[model samples]
Target: MCLLLIAWKVHPTCPLIVAANRDEFYRRPTKPIHRWDDGSGIVGGRDLTSGGTWLGVTASGRFAAVTNVRDGKAEGTPPQSRGALPTGFLDSTATPQAYAAAADGDDFAGFNLLASDLDELFWVSNRFDGAGVAVEPGIHGLSNAQLDTPWPKVTAGKAALAAAVSEDSGAPDADVESYFELLHSTDPAPRADLPNTGVGVRREKQLSPLFVRTRFYGTRASTVLRVRSDGSFDLTERTFNSRRQTGETRIEETS
Candidate 1:
């Protein structure tokens, strides 16, 4: 299970709160946040499969994110590498609203996209039975298996992020860094079974309270993006080690 949550403008302190947990096999090759493309911008984590990204914004006030829909057997179509969607969004100039609008009736193929260009944000999910959806700025969440579930983790994370954003507007950078720390606060004790277990012994481990669970499918990367009224952008990305230790990089760029 994975979850993504977003909170916009209504918060008194911060304008946005995005917390997501990306779930996949533990052996996937991913790099924590780092400077990308000759240092023109910075992004957190890279999905080595398709070279796409999960979250990132350019110094030029452009932003976008995407999550794979767990409901698909997206295997024989076009054969694009995994995570290519987010990678493409990172380098593009499409605004969220425009991108969503453009995707309104197109075939979704096999993913969901969150595209933004300085002023607006957009969401489109091909997994939603082939329809694209427009989601406004507010507290929002999504998981790999579904759009939004009433799962306790989704509720708690969204609420916590919302509350924190409402309480701290002083330095977006500081608030963002603290938020990353909070997201990465998971225990590192090795588990005897895989999270998505098919083994009988794993079933026993899943039943153990100490087995450790992930909120948003073990948040692999965390990001914060801010846009000034003048249309410039500032962004930061924090990547976590397998042990969940964290490091961050910040960038500022004009549109």
Candidate 2:
């Protein structure tokens, strides 16, 4: 996922609320969220090319998401696909911290990963020595940077997400729609505020919004998930391209 806005322990009934958009090239083969054929008890989109996933959840209350770090230089290809970071987390019996600590940072390209179990959230980055940090509860944002880095989009997304949740008066449907609206914005940040990720000004402008659009690359999927303290949850995935949308899939489940 390129952009993720999470309201962790901010809602009384819902412990986790996620609004996220995944950006990728249109040519990459992908499948929308589904029960994994391997009986992993996991549900999320799969990267057909890499046999991994960017984001997914398990019935046992484990959640994982990943974003590629933006490095200007190309190192050809890494030995491992970063998507496996999340898929492996959901598939294993390990805690989030153990899984993150075990990752061999040298095997993959630069990546920022978030892995959480029922009680705590953990963050690990291969670019930053592969140590894991527990994420505290509250509103948080992540993109192609360190956790809660004040990049323009991250800052705006966190604020928008906080507003969306606080304004939601216990209505699930309207609340989810409001969160989607926040993710659907395509406004570019002012040039002065764009982060210097080594990519040029023009490229930075293209990725400034919560939702991004470009000829060959853009947001392919948007997802909203709400996990209640009791483990019942609502998950929705919307797929689209630059010109128009493909479809939306909704999955609701209880513990």
Candidate 3:
């Protein structure tokens, strides 16, 4: 997941709201969101190349997501796939903090990970110094960089998510299409607002939008997940090929 917008414990009826986009090369092999048949009780899209998932939720009320850090530097090869970080947390019985704190960041490339056990949420990053920190209740955004780094897309996404949540206040469920609409915005940021993470201005501008598109690489999935106050959840994932929508899957589960 490249762009993750979260409204945690902010809404009256919904405790957790997530809107995210997974950006990757078009050639990568991926399977859309589905329950794992391996008896893990996990639901998420699978990275066929790595045998891991970028975002997932378990029937036991666990949630996890990951984003790679883009510094445009050559790190040769990392020992592990960042996708495994999230997969590990969802498959574990440990608390969010314990799992995050025990992670061996050196094994994987630079990444930011979010893990939640429904009662609490924690974030860990290999590129940062801390082990894991508890997330406060509110609207937040995360991109390739650290959490809430104020990039153009991150700021815009947070505002959009806040409005979506506010507009759906007192309702039992959020409007998933509104979140998808925001994720589909293709407007690029102004040159002055772009972040230079070693990528040149041209590439930076290309990746500035909430939704990114290029000749060979772009956003492939847009997912919206809401966890209600009663411990039920609604998850929707829309898959894309280039700029065209290819398929969609929605899942609802009651506690």
Candidate 4:
């Protein structure tokens, strides 16, 4: 996912709320949100390219997501592979911080990694400048820029999404499902002066379903994760297969 916004324990009304857009090839392999073994479940789209997922949460309250580093080519050496960091470790493991900190000796840059388990959330970005300051639990926003950055889209979107969840009165699953649509929407109306509207994407479809007709190499998906203070998590995925509605998964027992 290129964009991710999450509201963590800081909120008084809602414990956790996430909205993200997964950008990947149309053919990437990913299953819709569903209950899985080990009592772990996935609610976000997985990376078909590397099997790493953009954003998702485990039933036990672990969460993670990542966005690309948007910048022009630089003068320095670039990484051997864009998929160097194992972001897949976020949702699948418990000791994510220890796992990531172990990669300090390894070369890293060009990608961002965010992860959260039962108690905390953390972020990592390997770039020429350096990895970013680690992030802690609290509402956070991330985009192509960096973690907890004040970029307009990341900052503004986080606030708006948080407000949406706070004001919601219905079931969190329904309210958060609606919030997914808000994040997944990318209305592609043409711009008069800009020609291409400056919007990198041509159309927005759920589940990496939309085809741009160019080798179909693109990212398209959205995942919403909801976690309550009582130690329960839910993941809902909206993909090409399930256009508007999301496939739901209950991680830990809420009842």
Candidate 5:
């Protein structure tokens, strides 16, 4: 996932809510979110080429998601795929901190990972030094740089998410459609506000929007995952094909 907005332990009834968009090349092969028939008990979209997932959740209440760091100066492909980072955590019984510490950051390209066991949440980034730090209970944002980096999109997204959560809090059911509407925003940041991530200005401009749409590369999926107080969760993913919504998959499981 490229853009992630999270509201953790903020609502009265829900404890965790995540809204994310996964951006990738249009030619990349991917499978829409679904349960792993391999008995992994994991539900997420699969990167068919790499055989790993961007974000996923388990019936046991474990959740994980990862986003690649945008660094054009970094040369040489990393030895491992960053997708494995999240799947590794979801498939393990270890606590978030321990799992993050054991991960060999040098083995993979720059990445930011979020892991949770429904008890606590942690954020780890291979691009920086230090172990995974516990994520505070509040609304947070993440993009290509770092957690809560205040990129234009991140800032706007966090505010939009907070408003959405506020409107849905205490309600009988979450307004899942509203969350998707937020992610569907195609408005681009002003040129003066765009960040220089080493990608050329043209490319950077193309990626400045909350929902990216380019000729070859753009947001491929938008996902919303909500975990209620009872441990029951809802996950919905919408896949896109050249800016057109192609399919959607939703999974809701009771505790």
Candidate 6:
């Protein structure tokens, strides 16, 4: 996932709300959200190129998401894929802090990661010399730069998510579409607001919106996940191309 907006322990009846867009090349092979047949109890889209996931949640209420940091110097592939961060977390029994603390940040390119279990949320990043820090309750955002770095899209997403969660009823399906609408924005941030991430000005503007569109690469998926106070949850994932939505998957758990 390239942009992540999370509302943690903020809403009255909702404990967690996630709205994110996974920006990637159009030709990369990716499987939509699904239950892992490996019995890891993980449900998420798989990056077929790397055999890992960008975002996911386990049956035990563990959640994780990962985003790559935008650094021209770190453009080439590293020793490992960052997708393994979230997949590895869901596939293990370790707590968020423990998993983040033990992760070998140097093993991969610059990346930002979020890990959470039933109790708390944690964030770690190698680019900013980050460490495992427990996140407090409220809205938080992450993009290609760093966690809560206030990139235009990150700020917009964070506000939209907070509003959607605050206005929606407590039902599992309520406001799901609203969250998607929030993620579907295409407006680019103004020039002054765009972050100079080594990518040129034109390229930066192209990638500034909540959703991005380019011929070779863009946002391939927009996903919204809501986990209620009782542990019941719902996740909706929409797959896209350069033009329109190709498919959508909705998974719900009442328990």
Q: Against the hidden reference, what TM-scores do the models get?
A: 0.70, 0.96, 0.97, 0.68, 0.96, 0.97
RMSD of each candidate relative to the true structure: 5.8, 1.4, 1.2, 5.8, 1.3, 1.1
Best by lDDT: 3
Across 168-201, the per-residue lDDT of candidate 5 in tens digits comes to: 8533355688889999899988889989899888
- lDDT of candidate 6 over 1-255, digit per residue (tens): 789999999988878889999999999999999998998889999999999999998767889999988966646568999999999999999999999899898798888999999688999988776578889999999998767899999988888888898887868758588889999999999999999888899999999999999999999999988888777888899999998999999998778
**TM accuracy, model 3:** 0.97
lDDT of 3 at 46: 97
> What lDDT score is found at residue 44 in candidate 3?
92
Per-residue lDDT tens digits of candidate 4, residues 1-255?
666777766555446677776665656576554443433455444444455455666555666666666564453554433343434454346465765555452354456777667466667776424433456656677765567666444555676676666766535455565566567544322232112212334332221121112246433556666677765655555554323333444333463
Q: If both were scored by TM-score, which would come out higher, candidate 3 or candidate 4?
A: 3
Worst 10 residues of 1 by lDDT: 203-212
lDDT of 1: 0.54
TM-score winner between 1 and 6, please give it.
6
**lDDT leaderboard ranking:** 3, 6, 5, 2, 4, 1
lDDT of each residue in 98-131, candidate 2, tens digit only? 9888888888999999888867888899887548
lDDT of 3: 0.91
- Higher TM-score: candidate 1 or 4? 1
Error of 4 at 14 (Å): 4.0
Model 2 Cα shift for residue 111 (angstroms): 0.5
TM-score of 5: 0.96
Location of the lowest summed lDDT over 10 successive residues in candidate 2: 167-176
Superposition-based RMSD of candidate 5 using all C-alpha atoms, in angstroms: 1.3
Better of 3 and 5 by TM-score: 3
